[model samples]
Target: MTEPERRLWQIVRAGRLGFKFQRQVVLAPYIADFAARSERLVIEIDGETHGSDSAYDARRTADLEARGYRVLRFTNADVMTNPEGVARTILMALGRDPESPLSPTLSP
Candidate 1:
C-alpha cells in the first residue's frame, strides 16, 4: 500500500466508517484500493500514474459501475493532506449521517 493508502486504511478498516472495507480487493478484472462490497462501493487511491490514464480509468470506472459498483477516486495528496475530509466523503457515500460525532473532522 502507498503511504496515503496506509493512512486511510487506519480509519477505514474494521467498520470504522459504519461499513467494512477491504484493502486491495480484487473486483474481477481490477483491484480496488478499498471496497465495501455490501454497499457496492469501490474507492481508488490514485497517484501520479493516474494523471496520465484518465481514459483507462474512465473505462474501468464504467465497467465497475455497469457491475453495480460505485467508484470513488481520490488523489494521493487529498488523502495525505485531508484524510478526515476523505473519511467524511466516504461516510456520505455510504449514506451515513455526516453530522454524526463519529464523522471525521479536520484537526486544528
Candidate 2:
C-alpha cells in the first residue's frame, strides 16, 4: 500500500467507521484499493500519476457502479493532508453520522 493508503487503512479498518473494509479486493478484472462489500462501496487512493488516467478511471468507476458498487476516489495529497476530513466524507457516504460519539477523529 502507498503511504496514504496505509494511513487511511489504520483509520477505517476493523469496522472503525461502522463498516468492514477489505484492502485490495478483486471485483472481476479490477482490484479496489479498499472495499466495504457490505455497503457496496469501493474506495480508491490515487497518486499524482492518476491525473493522466481520468478517462480510464471513469470507465472503471462506471464498471464498478454497474457491478453494484459506489466508487469513491481520493488523492494521495488529500489523504495525507486531511485524513480526518476524508474519513468524515467517507462516513457520510456510508450514510453514518460522522459526529456520532462512536466516530473517531483523525489521530495526531
Over 4 Å off, model 2: none
**Which candidate leads the pack in lDDT?**
2
Q: lDDT (0-100) at residue 68 of candidate 1?
A: 99
Q: Candidate 1 at residue 58, lDDT?
A: 99
Local error of candidate 2 at residue 30 (angstroms): 0.2
- In candidate 2, list every pair of residues with a backbone clash: none
Q: Per-residue alpha-carbon lDDT of model 1 for 1-108, expressed as tens digits?
A: 789899888878877777889998999889999999999999999998999999999999999999999999999998998888888888889998878877644332
TM-score of each: 0.92, 0.95
Q: Model 2 reaches what TM-score against the true structure?
A: 0.95
Error of 1 at 43 (Å): 0.3
* Clash pairs (backbone) in predicted model 1: none
What C-alpha lDDT do the candidate models reach, one value each?
Answer: 0.88, 0.91
